[model samples]
Target: MDAKELIRALNARDEAAGPDLLARTKATGPLEIRGELLYAPLVRNWYELTDSLELIPAKAPEWRPLQCGIDERAQAATGYLLALAEADVFSGVVRLSRGEEILFEEVYGWADQDRRRPNLPGTPFNVGSMNKMMTSACVGRLMEQGDVRLDDKVIRHLPGFRPDITARITVRQLLTHTSGMGDFFGPKFFAGGRHRLETIDDHLDLIRDDELLFEPGARFEYSNSGFVVLGAIIEARSGCSYADYVREHVFEPAGMRSSDFPAFHELDGQAIGYTNFTAHGAVTGPRRPHEDTLPRRGSAPGGGYCSAEDLARFGAALMRDTLIGPDVKAALLGLRSDSGSGRPGGVPYAHGFQVESEHGVLSYGHGGGGPGISAFMDVFPDQGLTLVALSNYDDGARQIRRELRRIFWPAA
Candidate 1:
């Protein structure tokens, strides 16, 4: 349904969902509710069933970029997206690359609302899930060095990997999120008495049951635990911590000076995080020090931060074959899993990146979101366009990406 109607349904069907009217607002700050009303649905056959209404606010998931043909129509569409991002109705940053020329670069929104700090082009922010791509890149470098193989069993590296996983999962499975490992930050850790562990090894205590979401490699299920296990593999095989391996190989090789894995030392120019507090009439302030609010430094499963420009530079370097061998990099971007209904080899999931399918068009990249920020970077190979968007606010980054895709590839 439309944003309003769906909101009304949620409010009426379950008062607990709304709690107090205008519980929290969007990136624009406290919203003014103009008397709620319910009406027709935005799409047919879509219905709301449950409205638990817990304030479990979350950032949006990243959308893949479907390659678009570079023609007159596509160019006009791309221009329109540039204009929309400039309006600042949505906080975002995007970069479009065509060969050696930089076609589009822009930033919008308040980095810090109260201090009036704008999110400049070079501003650094946490690229939550986007870190997974970097994590995969770290693994790729190790593979290039013959330190690990895609077919290697994860347990072979993890000295005392949970018994349930030691004999069942593969490196490729973990990279593709098909290992059936439970989500590392979910209920198993939240509910069990072992949520305080900070390192990847600290998470093993909750892996005792080692339940698979599905048979290994049977289906694609996004699991943070899969990445955590992958991190362990990197540590065990490389004889280096995940952060160090990535810094020495991926980041340094790509010349991404502004990017880094979250470390225990002080970081310069790190964007502060924020969350809304409706208890005192929608007070937006710095995130508290709870497990959910404070970011853990050693989190290899996610939470690497970077600037928009650095990400674009990395994409350009990757396309030029300066980072990894052309053939090996291509295989890393090629389809390695069938995640949906499509041609025999279609639905995409590459080694450490995401493959996009839009009719005959294809693109590869990854997006990341965390408590205080969200980011996405997709490289359109044929079009030579690399689109990067990062936001300081929580959930709005995905919407900006959706609108960008709609502008560039309407059919997608």
Candidate 2:
């Protein structure tokens, strides 16, 4: 069958057949056209577009020679990224840099779908969980000043912490997401309203009474509440609010002039976050505004606005030891857990960065996602390459990153 017919057939299949049958069918072979393979993964109830290219044949007549050199690869990457943008697969800003030189940069899609404001190269996008890196840097600075220690108990900083539950949880555990604390985004969060939970202390009631998911340091479990507690620690030790501390210590030092944790309604050159639905009813694709889906303001664990260029600047600063000392930076970027074992891309988890091994080379970065935003930033220190992608749509950044990685590191 042709592509359209194949999609129709796939869509007509019984939903009760489930992912197992779909996986089995996909394993048979993807449809091939002009040397390219097409495989769509199941998303929720339907097949969604994904990047899963696998070269089965030794050679294809339509294939071009591999551009392995840096300049050649950069050109190929730019062309590929433009094509993806043209095809509506990628949206927002992307930048790839080597050392101090930017190899490629492009912007796509709309910042405000209603106003038709095109997403400029400097458009700030909400980087959901990526703010954890900034929080980590604040902790690192506090550690450098002899204000805190990794092994120090959580109760040492937050006196209100439960003696029985959080007493054994250390700062290190919080940083590495091994503290066993559960997330704060539960029934209470929605009930309490986002505006009320504006500060680190504001989230304490949500977490203070809750029990741990497991014993501290037992395993790797992502805990947004753990980072909230860390933010409290930063405030208690540094005598500054989480946002203020990060701005002064992290963003300012990193030369990230365009990054901030603004209130939800603030839209100053930042993209208007969009999703597929609103409370009114089912909205059309890419047009539904996510105004009620965001917090009044961002906090320590996540929810910060930054441009792609600002993210690249943050990476460069981390590498140059501008934000934290060398020892602190090393600890912050060090591999602290094997959290990526079963992850989609097999990328390991570092202190605040995601570590990925491509062929024999390693790269460090982080990705963030939420209601209507997705973001990714990577720094290949060995090759002096840094990549940053920020999108206004929830599912836009991942596939773009995948395709760009293939362009730069084809062997992997």
Candidate 3:
């Protein structure tokens, strides 16, 4: 019934499950958990081992599975994460999917303290800039239908796009963050230095006085203004508001019913984002509501909420050809430069996703961060796997992604 007993049974099942995409040994090589390699012989291949146990119970009803179909590794991970959640590190969900099928979907931590409600599988958490991926998807669909192309110049949609030094910027440059737009947000937009700006025009107006950081497409500079502009272009081109276009085409097609670019006041079961401000992990601050965080209402650059399950379904559908056609999907995953210099380069920013190659496998997804929350969802095409993690508190989803990557896909 306990984790140890479940692990032993799972070990037996794993040996028989045969070769899986998840490495059985040294999968922990690339990842370190609290200064130690997390995967050992004792807990390698946890997913299969645990999944096999589930199958056996269904096949033989006479024997009752004492545990609730959860494995030791999951229990250990949950314990560690819940400890962090209680300490206000974060609250969200972690979901694993293989193609169109979800293998594991679990929620952790409280959605709110005032209501004393814990986050369940369907609880929604804001994805922040991670919503850029969805914006990109809408753009890709437009391309698929010949409404646009990556090479199209921004001026095609917005004549004012090039009124200054931005005239040569292309759709691809904006999507890849290669536009020469300044990374700085205007001082007029700052509210006590929290970096919240409202309205697409408000964002553009903030940056309007600044000169281009570099020539268009010459190098990469992450500019939120670029996607804000893209959202505007989506609206102008689609003849609908950017949010409505994405909700109708991208979210609906992907079966992500729980996902939306909702107003802050509209959200009912959503968790407010939070950030920790301690080394010993004591003091914490919740992210002010988006309305309080931004100067504008709802702009396409960011502001979307979704559950882990919904995100996994979205990723699975994208990989399974339910969203776009084959040619469009290829364009979506192709590697392009993301000129983020502080981190390692060579990661490609595709249509609405990041194409990262690790251990001879391609993992594509985006991470979202807002005032207080962080979220990440990666789809591993080689293994037909998708891993999604959402955190109500800042920095929580990053650790979850790093840890679960090892647990589900250990290095050989």
Candidate 4:
């Protein structure tokens, strides 16, 4: 069926199932809502009662990469990307690079809309969950130094770690999002003063009494609390703050001079996040300020700020082994879980990176979103292509990356 027909069928099914579909499916298994396949226990019951139709799974299109020269493909892709950015009202900095050569770089819209401060190539934007990659890199360095082990339990490093809930969670599980830990951002996080969550330890309080979402390693569930625990482990083992450890080990070695996890009050050239208000595929109201929507400072799970150039530098550093050893780098890029299917466009999860595979070509990176921020960094290692986009407005970065992928990997 066509896209419109498929969407209509899905919506009709959803409406028939009512709001209790999720709850009803809990007894059987998690709902899998891929194209032409809707497997929910409650829906199955309804389907068994009706003999009029049968559900047949549709085969996914085979993906293959287009054969093309790297430089020629990149140049052609740049024009399409620029057009997509203009059409989408993309407000951010984007940089495309091949090895050490920058193929294209541009900035759009305002950093501070009220102040009329236009976003520059060097302007920093908050990369929400991309900080997890940096955190994992820091852990990898420690592992290389024989300071930590992936199999080590949380209680070994974190003195105050709850034995009941986190006793079985390993460093590897935390890195891979296989840990059963829940997130720190919830009702408690929002209701509590943002100023109180300035440090890793402070963020811990939000999840201190929470129960495991599931048995450790039983399934993959993205947990910000897991990363927070990882940050605390880094601090405890290194005898330094998480920020200081990353700055010295990851940022310095990667040549990310302008990137940092600074407090909200310390923002300088960073963009003021604007919340997009949309209705019926069109912008509706004036964008709202994103200041009060975030924590006072960035955390291990995410919220570090960096320029597009610095993000590209990070990808280059990883490729050159400036931050991690060969073994750790391999593990970081390796597929650990297929967890991010429900949101963020279905990218698979790696140790700390997001793995996107199209046409048998794998790209390793991460994308992040928050109140008024959207950021993405993709590293196509085999192709020597690294694309970084950072935006101050929510939902601004993905389309540009999507267009770039389509242009460069036409067959995909």
Candidate 5:
């Protein structure tokens, strides 16, 4: 097949590109094609070409959020969310701010279905992978304190943590998902095994032996295992557990009183996650409590809870160098890697943030979604805008975010 035709087929997921075809397509180099996985710019995501000739979406587009209010000019945005709420699709909070001014804010749906408790603007929702920002900040705090360096080997802080495998990985690589460590998800993680892992140190037992996917500092791959190791390093350097370190250094300083990796049982009146996702990341049917699909609690990689206000506080603090220093924040948010990491082309992964520039507008943020949780927060530094959307229903934040984006940045 021709190069263009091959790219079209791969993107459509209708025709599989074998090794010979992939090599041929790479030689063409006309469509920004990468080896093994296809980087389809049109889709703004990466797809893995399995041996069976099936194309699987590796990750979703990793950027964009918005700020606006309900007015005649923004009726579409407001109506869109109201429509979803009417359909029982949206359940959580949407907060938008320009500096200290709240441009828009609202809450909808039930926090507790059985209790008939409605969601409030203050309700905390599990932010699937959004916790990675704080994990990054934790590492940055240590970096500022001279307790760690990005280039230092992971084995330095976590010497006993898979020394044979971690010796080659660096702190920067781990933060940027370039450490080559795969995720801990499997039948074991989804099955009854998750309950046994309550603490960050306990998760070391869950890291698979066959975790290495590529050489250190190679291509970018989303890794829960890498963050797990970073969490361990945070504990070792701070002379305390990772949770304690984050609470004292990351959250308290940032005024994120409502954010933390609280366990399911420890939670009090937080919005319960409602997911349609099964263990394998597939939607089964209607949304329900996602307790069965969750780990015992959130950890370094993600699964922390936060309210929109708390997240706004975090974004502000992060930008203002409240949790980390100026140079540290800039270096962490700088484009450090540009491998095929499922983000839009030219939008590389920063330390923990995803940096993007579209239509001459620069923004950085992170998104997390799984089953009953869909959370996203973005900061538009030039516009002085911070947008946060947190939800309890399965993939509920997407529509809200898209509408808000259109409302605020219509041409984008």
Candidate 6:
């Protein structure tokens, strides 16, 4: 059924599923919502569900590159993306790469629909929690410098944390999302004054007194606050702000000139992020710009910007060990936790990266987006391939990423 019919069904069938699903979606940190049809990052991707609106409840949950003569597959992928664009279902960039050479690239929709400013190849899109990988790399750098250790307590690096809460957390737990720390985004984040959270300290100040949701190393959970704490720790130990550290160590060395934590007010050339969910997450609402819901600037946990090319460059750097030393790289990319809570089957996580394995082939990457922002990046090390999909429309990159995955990888 269409959205209208589906809403009718939901109203007759249940009353509170929208808010519950919205809460779970917000907890994903990127705040991804596509009206009644939303998906959580990493934890849940969209599905071809039945017409019954499956609204009651639930929980949440890739491919190859060039060098092959797969014209039909390539054309099919392009057609699917074009259909999404034509139907106003997507607005963003989809880039598939084979090593340094691009295999398929497409730009869709307007960066500013009113001014008719179309999103260009270099247009920076808010990458949401994908920035966690960058934050993870900064931690790795500190580890290599011997300034921090995986076993180090949060209190060791960030003494300002409540000892009882922090003593139970470790650098490794934070990286692997087993820290038992919850996210910083919820009612309080959107309650107001988020614009004042311009620095890591500002965000940390908000979560310093938080209660741990579980014991450290209890299990795998996607904790945006955990990454925020990592950002603060990076600043405290390296004596450099997280942004500067990323720019110097992660972006510059990887040739990612267009990636950085630019302030929301200064988003002149960046894509204007849009969303359908209110801060309260209206399951069905008119579309709106996504900036007013943001902080003054992006933080360690998420809210950074990057172009498709730069994102691909960053992925390549991760695979080449340019972002961290060999040992750290190997450890960070190895599957560290079972991520099959309600997610796609057989998916596991390693530190900050999401691992997808099928038919004895492995792909490492992360998905980031929420509301008016959608992005996905993956590197098939065994195949020498990379995929980057970014969008300013609500869950814009999701469809492109999903369809491409069908072309590149099998269900088995």
lDDT of each: 0.61, 0.72, 0.64, 0.74, 0.75, 0.75
RMSD of 1: 6.8
Per-residue lDDT over 236-317 for candidate 6, one digit per residue giving the tens place of the 0 to 100 score: 8878888998899999999988888888778778898878777455544446788777877897888999999998888888
Q: In model 6, what is the error at residue 215, expressed in angstroms?
A: 1.6
lDDT of 4: 0.74
**Candidate 5 overall Cα lDDT vs. reference?**
0.75
lDDT of 2 by residue, 107-172 (tens): 888998878899998889999888988888889999999988888888888777687866788888
True lDDT of residue 330, candidate 4: 76
Off by over 4 Å in 6: 1-53, 56-68, 283-285, 335-346, 410-412
Task: List runs of model 3 lying over 4 Å from the truth.
Answer: 1-76, 184-186, 192-202, 276-291, 295-298, 335-347, 410-412
Weakest lDDT window of 10 consecutive positions for candidate 4:
41-50
In the range 1-412, model 1's lDDT, one tens digit per residue, is: 5455655766887776654423333233223222332211110011223335533323223444446554543465456544444543345566555544656566666666657677787777777788777777777777787888777787777757775566788887888777777676555554553335556676555555667878888877777778878888888888877778878776787777888755423445655444442223234454431224433453566777688777777787777776776655765675434222111123466666777866466777887654455678887766666777777555446545645655455222
**Model 1 ranges off by over 4 Å:** 1-89, 188-198, 203-210, 263-265, 276-291, 336-347, 408-412
Q: Write the per-residue lDDT of candidate 4 for residues 1-412, one digit (tens) a residue.
A: 5423533554576665332333233322334554435543221221121222333323333434447765666666555545545544467887888766877776788888889999998898999999999998998888888888888888888756787766788888898888888887777876765658889888887678888888888877888889999999899889999999989998898888899988778888888888753322224347777777788899789988988888898999988888987787776666434222212235677778887777767788888887688888988877777888898877678534655565566322
Q: Which residue segments of model 2 deviate by more than 4 Å?
A: 10-66, 277-286, 335-346, 410-412
lDDT ranking, high to low: 5, 6, 4, 2, 3, 1
Clashing pairs for predicted structure model 3, backbone only: 27-410, 27-411, 162-167, 197-295, 198-295, 198-296, 199-296
- Candidate 3 or 2, higher TM-score: 2
Cα RMSD (angstroms) for every candidate in the order listed: 6.8, 6.2, 12.8, 8.3, 8.7, 6.3
Candidates 3 and 6, the one with greater TM-score:
6
Error of 3 at 343 (Å): 7.2
Error of 1 at 248 (Å): 1.5
Structural similarity to truth (TM-score) of each candidate: 0.73, 0.83, 0.74, 0.79, 0.80, 0.83
